[model samples]
Target: MLATPSDFDVLIVGAGISGIGMAAHLEMMCPRRSYAIVERRDQIGGTWDLFRYPGIRSDSDMHTLGFVFEPWRHEKSIADGPSILEYLNRIADERGIRPHIRFGYKVVSADFRPDEARWHVTVELADGERKLLTANFIYLGAGYYDYDDPYDAGFDFSEFEGDVIHPQFWPKDYDYTGKKVVVVGSGATAVTIVPSMADKAAHVTMLQRTPTWMFSRPAKDAIANFLRKVLPEKVAYAITRFKNITMQDFSFKAARNKPEKVKQALHKRIEKALGKDYDKEAFTPPYNPWEQRLCLVPDNDLFEAMKSGRASVVTGNIAKFEKDGVRLTSGELLPADIIVTATGLKLAIAGKIKISVAGEPVDFSQRYYYKGCMFSNLPNLAVVFGYLNASWTLRADINSEFVCRVLNHMEATGTNLATPVLTAEAEAKIEDDDLFDFSSGYIQRGKHIMPKSAKDYPWRLNQEYVFDRKVLRQGDVDDGLLSFTRAGANAMMAEEQLEAAE
Candidate 1:
């Protein structure tokens, strides 16, 4: 059965942080430009609402993580999962975006029509019923991970007596009180959960194949909190946000420039935190800083737990999972009643949705990215890929603003369509590189699935927020690369509709 197709000027997929942020921007910037957001899950918060694992928190500071328009109010910049979800919900409700959201709709496919200058989006609902939606423009905020298809590290723990858990789909009712918990993997999740679960569990063991760079920071931003009390909310937020961003930018550049010096300094910090008894070898990572995400420990919580003898770090390859715990390749057995796999997310490009142009399936890996927000040769479509170094919202904020500008530009001109088409010569000249330069287990596992990046501007992943802001926010939209055209009657539809609405 052909479902009722609701036509919108713009269609946003996923009601997560990025989608919601974009939706809010559309309302504020292009108020007359009608749009609807489709969320796969029933809930509004994407990762924040989904992950119910203990001690789930943002790796970056909330001052920068929070939306540019609305500053983070709380002192605790490194907020927990629930708090972040609450913040997103508040933004949705206050912006009157909740009514425009169609929950339980998973985008299955998007087919663009060059003739009509429109997209026909197909989404599957919870009841297996599929609906066809039409939109002039599509902004996919469907994050860079597959929530449904979590990355399985393929640990041979099939015969383990105790229950095994993945942080991606943490059970709501499960309790780990008084249980000996063994957390697998040494990414952000493992580092976070170890300290959190240690409080309730008998003891928590962080089992890692390799070490990650762990840096301790204050849980609360005292300066930001103090400024909020003294100055105007917006003023305080702006100052604090810049301060954090500058520090982060400097630190990342310094690390990249002097890898050994940065690595030694990081090791020294970890050594100081864990004392001389702790194996410094276990704290040293093989890869250089920024090659993988730097693990953030708020107030040295993870280290403090390890120092108190409540939590421990075990660096070894798992031989197999025994009835009680996991056995290492070195013949060491760590006893545990529960095992938590903190293996990183399965990196997804545009939420696994099948896209086609004129009935031909589009190969995203072949397509070049245009200024981080869009893809070359993809018409009227954009995907929000955030910063690999700084806060995700930093890039998201710029993306939303750029999208608004693009829509505005389309309306100003008689053209209703725009697509970034890379020239054959340009494509041939640009050297291809990994989409994300990180060497983490999950990224390495899914590197084949990720896009091949180009070397220069409008194609490469800069990894810096500053470069994105300049290119995406201030760069010319009608640059020679992007081709804009018009359909028959709808050529002036954008301008007309906006005028009519106004």
Candidate 2:
């Protein structure tokens, strides 16, 4: 236990988008609070920095993905990886957040000391040395996937002579020029990679077990660009963000309420993009529009590549990998010089950091998610899990603001502890709900590790951003559910207070 002169008010994990957003919020709303950020990677921009595959870009528009406090001045709303990194860097430098970030430091585990009302965080440095730090609160801004490993689809590449690669660990400057490339998935990564690689590769094939629904939109937002020319940057950004958020919510609701109609509209757009002669089976997914995230194609680039015979789509399971190429279950042989396994990600909760309360390990699966941020019975800790239906930053912004509110309330009340306590009776009364309603492979596989959700507010991670914004932003801090107490308070006293409130 290394002792320091003072503990940080908040210790943020992962200097990514969520961490940066939370830090910026603290600066504005709780300026008196001290904080620090620990990043596992050597650089900023968590997702954007990690991925270096061709045509790597945001699935959602930048208006909503960009932080609420900062304006995305780039021309392209569907920004590339470098552009997004630049935006994040500008925010970090401009807000003086870079100085507070400690790169190459990975959080191994965190233990909450109830008596001290602080978390003892153990971190492993890049050189494999361990150090300890204490903080009043811990904010996990680390993004949801396993950074060390990608999803393994169990493809037998033993006999395949081609260079196999996963997008998570793309080799630097590895040329695929004039080589036949087969991207083994039809998710956003495959869609982005096929067209990008087709320019240099001899031919590119997007191989998928099942088709994925895709929608085509321009890379640049005409309305957003026009507004920027006439109005103030912040005002224009706000309007654009509002418009996009509304459209996203409406689209999701429409897909859920009227799946057939939404499906037809999506197919109609794809039909217009790809000619009538195109293979419809390869483009049509069995699921509804929003069941899984709809891949976005910028300016019909994918369609153009397919039309030009540079790229193609193959919808089938791989029977085995042959020396020359992949052999499909349909007995079709596709020749390839390189294979990219864009088979999606493996989700890890709380950045896979071992969390415990008073020496007893906390099982998040047994606990309830409180207001889409903190887990029930967890003291002074909040994890940022972004919304599935909208831009990741939408939830990030709201969660950051909400956490700040809790911190400020605790300060005003002279309390150092805030915990969402769910009693046995209350827990039994709440019916369990799925953490996420999406049928995406990652979501389905990661359900067991996720925090439990319930049927009502303040007890579940709500997916509706509009509803969450109002409740998390404007709702009272002392809502009878969250117990605020001073440091060194006995457990019995907190329980008695909760009982009295109930």
Candidate 3:
């Protein structure tokens, strides 16, 4: 892997969970390949660094959220935002992944030159200068949620007197102590904030358009703790990871197959916690479980808060923001000193980076993902979008390994460019599947701009991590559909051979 004019062999965008994991894998596997990561933010720990709202944490357990190569040594399975950030920071420090990260490098555009076998990327630097860098391949691990543009509920709060806030940019010094708080939206953020804010707030209300499915799990995983006490670190971690993944898969699959049974069981437990005052209709969603992600409440903190009368839940539409608080469509006035709009995230398709191949801009909506990593007909470009149903890191790990395998294959075959080539027949067989099968507000809002998927193997997203892990990890690298060609004189021989065969 001799160095060339193209700054490095590979350029990875974003230092988030996916990006960090990708960098780790590259360093471990393709040690000789010169790679650098460009992060728009000034710091690492992408999600854990960006979101700082009260009680902001992973809905997924730490066992799976933790990287496959690393074992989570923490006692709490349901970790807080700060703890997660610390974990990520520890990983970067221990693995020496920090030096390879170029913070404050916001990539605005990436143009691939097939003839030249290189990608010219333009990044907006902190000093307002546009820097053009080149790389042989580009891996977009920027993540899906757009922190810049959180989904605005379009509420006209000009008439209101309270402070409006969004969880994406929570102020560090802002105080809500003894203040009445009303959090809009029933997703994970709302549930988390309600319990956390209720500790000191005069009262907290979770206002929602519709109820989202919520499940309760213990904050501390007893089984994992016990196993670690007896078994070796690696051995205990492996067993715990497998158990959690299996349970997650089973829960999701069972929900899909028998949503009613799962719904009833969930409602029953919530009802028990909420007591007789629980409005079953208000808490019941029209959609089935897993249609949207199931919100998780560790140790029933939200329910405990509600039961203690410090917090409550209200399901209704907003008429307008009144002088004191939000006026429900039913004319119920929920007074609040502060309103946190935990509405949802705005999807950043391809990290909002302008990507082009041979001067033609890539319209991702028309392109289907190859094995949920590489885009169809896109050359030397791969995106590590993780599983919706499981830990995001799970898919990231698989995609990163697959990228390494592709790199190895290219080097073995002496190919400069690798592109997923689809025949007319293959394209015709493509099914119009959503890139992510989620019903969250943010996802539905950006549905039109999302990438497409197919019904065929590799092209069709299995959505399950187990299926992807098997295929992507064990499958052949020199697949027929993935076309590779040498840069200059060597490519002529490949064309000649193809022409002779026809």
Candidate 4:
């Protein structure tokens, strides 16, 4: 039996950093309006709380990753997972957003009904009971990466007599101490896990299918720390945030404008850190800088691990899983007591919730992203997704502010529906490399599921703070693609337009 529908002015999914940010903005914009933030987990911190692998941490600097309105009070720029999680929890508690979050409620599907001009949401409870809800607007703050098991279940793990573990679905009771372990994958997660686990494990081997460019920076920002000691936490946080943002803008510009120089500098850094004896071809990516995410090494822990003879790196394809270990394509048999598959995550956009309009499924693959927020033909729904190059929160903060502006505009104008009106022709011809060129598993799933543009101003992902501020923060809201309609008028909009034309 379906329970009575819970109504709200705004309903947000995923209670993560993005969702909470949106909720805070909504509260500030319309205090009298009803809003709810739904989360599947018992706790609030989305990725930070879910991932419990050995020495888990953020790959990006914390100065840029933390919320803009609320500064992160931590001394370190690159933070471990627990510290990051604690900071998020503290923000929720301090901001009074915790009370608004409905824990253990997973939204299964959401359908937009034109008749009511509202979204009908179906959510499943922790107790295996289903509930129905309706709202004027739906905000998808659910992140891109899947939080479930990290490994591909189809992999023939049974053939390996050794214990296998995926970082996403870590076992609490299992101990890696004094055991020879092989960690697979070459991205940030694998790079981090090997160095941290090497000290505890007897021997840690990092098996990379393709080498990624790794760079080292100190975990603690000396300037930021000095400022924290002299000034307030909030003030220091702001200073660090500005510094990080400016640095990112400069780096992105340099990479784009002076590609050769950026590549040369990157090559020099890798050579200096990895030593001249290291295979340069295996370590350097074939694409330009920021084509894929770069690996972050805090204070060169990965190199230190290698120097101490506790860790080693190998580049090869896995042929098959043997009873005792992995067999590489080079015909080398690496003995491993434990295998860690840090393979990438599954991409789940809008938390993979099914959406339908007038009983017809809304094919996300066919739709286009409007300014990387709302989708074409989908009214009153916005998603939060950041750039692959720059800090995620910086982009998300802009998105949050934009959402508030949109909501305020709707209220003041008496508009109930706003949707991007991209034509089939525009969507079909628009081509950008970021949309389809990615080889990552997550990108593969969402290939062509977003808007792609080279120019950063109107619809492109410039990843520059300056460009984003001018276009997203201060740009005109009444762009040509967005259409607004009042309540009870959506149904008659097409008919009225035809009559007026006649």
Best model per lDDT = 2
Estimate candidate 2's RMSD in Å: 2.0
lDDT of 4 by residue, 44-68 (tens): 8788778888889988888888888
Candidates arranged by TM-score, highest first: 2, 3, 1, 4
- By TM-score, the best candidate is 2
Q: In model 4, what are the clashing residue pairs, if there are any? A: none
Q: Residues 1-502, candidate 2, lDDT per residue (tens digit)? A: 2355336999999988999999999999999999999999999999999999999999999999999989999999999999999998998898889998999999999998876788989999999999999999999999999999999988788899989999999999999999998999989999999999999999999998899989999999999999999999999999999999999999999999999898888778888988777787887888888999999999999999999999999888889999989999899999999999999999998999999988889888888899999988788999889988899999999999999999999999888889998887787689888778889999999999989999898899999999999998899989988989885555567756545433
lDDT (tens digit, per residue) of candidate 3 on 1-502: 3245789899999888888888899889888899999999998888888988888888999999999998999999999988888888888889888999999999999998866889999999999999999999999988887869898778899988988999999999789999999999999889899999999999999999899899987999999999999999989999999999999999999999998999998998888778866888877898999998889999999999988999999999999998899999999999989999988888888899999977889898877778988977777999977787999999999999999999988888889788777655667756666666777778788878877787667775568899899988999877887778876757565444333322
Off by over 4 Å in 2: 1-6, 489-491, 495-502
Give the residue spans of candidate 3 off by over 4 A: 1-4, 490-502
Using lDDT as the measure, name the better of candidate 2 and candidate 3.
Answer: 2
Give per-residue CA lDDT, model 1, range 251-317, as digits (tens).
9998899999998888788778878677887888888898888999999999999888999999999
The residue pairs found clashing in candidate 1 are 377-420
Summing lDDT over every window of 10 consecutive residues in candidate 2, give the lowest-scoring window: 493-502
> Which model, 3 or 4, shows the larger lDDT?
3
Q: In model 2, which residue pairs have backbone atoms overlapping below 3 Å? A: none
RMSD in order of candidates: 4.8, 2.0, 2.4, 3.4
Clashing pairs in 3: none
